[model samples]
Target: MEWLMYVSVAIIAIAFAVLVFYIIQTLLSLKKTMENISHTVDGMKSQVDEISKESTQLLHKTNELTEDLQYKSNTLNSVFHAAEDLGHSFQKLNGSLRKVSETVSKQADDNAEDVAKAVKWGSVVMSFWQKWKTEKTTKQADPGKEAN
Candidate 1:
């Protein structure tokens, strides 16, 4: 029995020693993890700040681009208006040209009948002249040749 009591005490002491050793090791590992986390947080802070600066620069550029685009669009709009005005002017010119063509056609039509009447009178006069010339030449050709 005395030997048994000694063995039991030895086992309990060994278990306690093992528990204390493991607890100390776990605490040391936890401290190392905390230190690593702190270093990582510091690095993240610097990266975030750099990203913020870049974001600000990008925003400024975007604003400038927007203003430039607005100005260009306004200029394009004015150009479009000018083109539209030109189209209207050309349409008016075309209308005037059409009107002039119609007037010239009407004037030519009005003169056509008078020209035809003049041509008819000229033909009648030409026939009379031809008859008179034939009679005069026959009378003057030989005086007794019985008509040329």
Candidate 2:
């Protein structure tokens, strides 16, 4: 009976030691996993910071581009306005030319009959003058002829 009791006590002690050893090993492994997680978090934090800085720079560049585009658009707007003004001026010039052409046409139409009458009168006067010159030449050639 004394030998059996001693053997049972030794077996219980051995089992307790084994349990303790396995617990220690699990704790060590958990510690290593925690360290790796901490390092990964640090790396991720640095990468996030870099990304933030780049994002800020990109935002600033985008703003600059937007401002430049706005300025150019304003300048282009002025050019378009100038072109519109020029188009208006051309339209006014065309309208004035049209009015002048219509007025000249109207005056020509009004004077057409007067111009024809003047041409007829000029022809009649030219015929009388030619007849008078011919008579004068005939009288000069024949000095003793009558004045008829």
For 1-148, candidate 1 gives per-residue lDDT tens digits of: 9999999999999999999999999999999999999999999999999999999999999999999999999999999999999999999999999999999999989999998999999999999999999988988886887643
- The whole-model lDDT of each prediction reads 0.97, 0.98
Write down the TM-score for model 1: 0.70
* Cα error of candidate 2 at position 82, Å: 1.3
Instruction: Please give each candidate's TM-score.
Output: 0.70, 0.70
Clashing residue pairs, candidate 1? Answer: none
Residue-pair clashes per candidate, as listed?
0, 0
lDDT of 1: 0.97
**What is the model-wide C-alpha lDDT for candidate 2?**
0.98
**Model 2 ranges off by over 4 Å:** 1-5, 116-148
Worst 10 residues of 1 by lDDT: 139-148
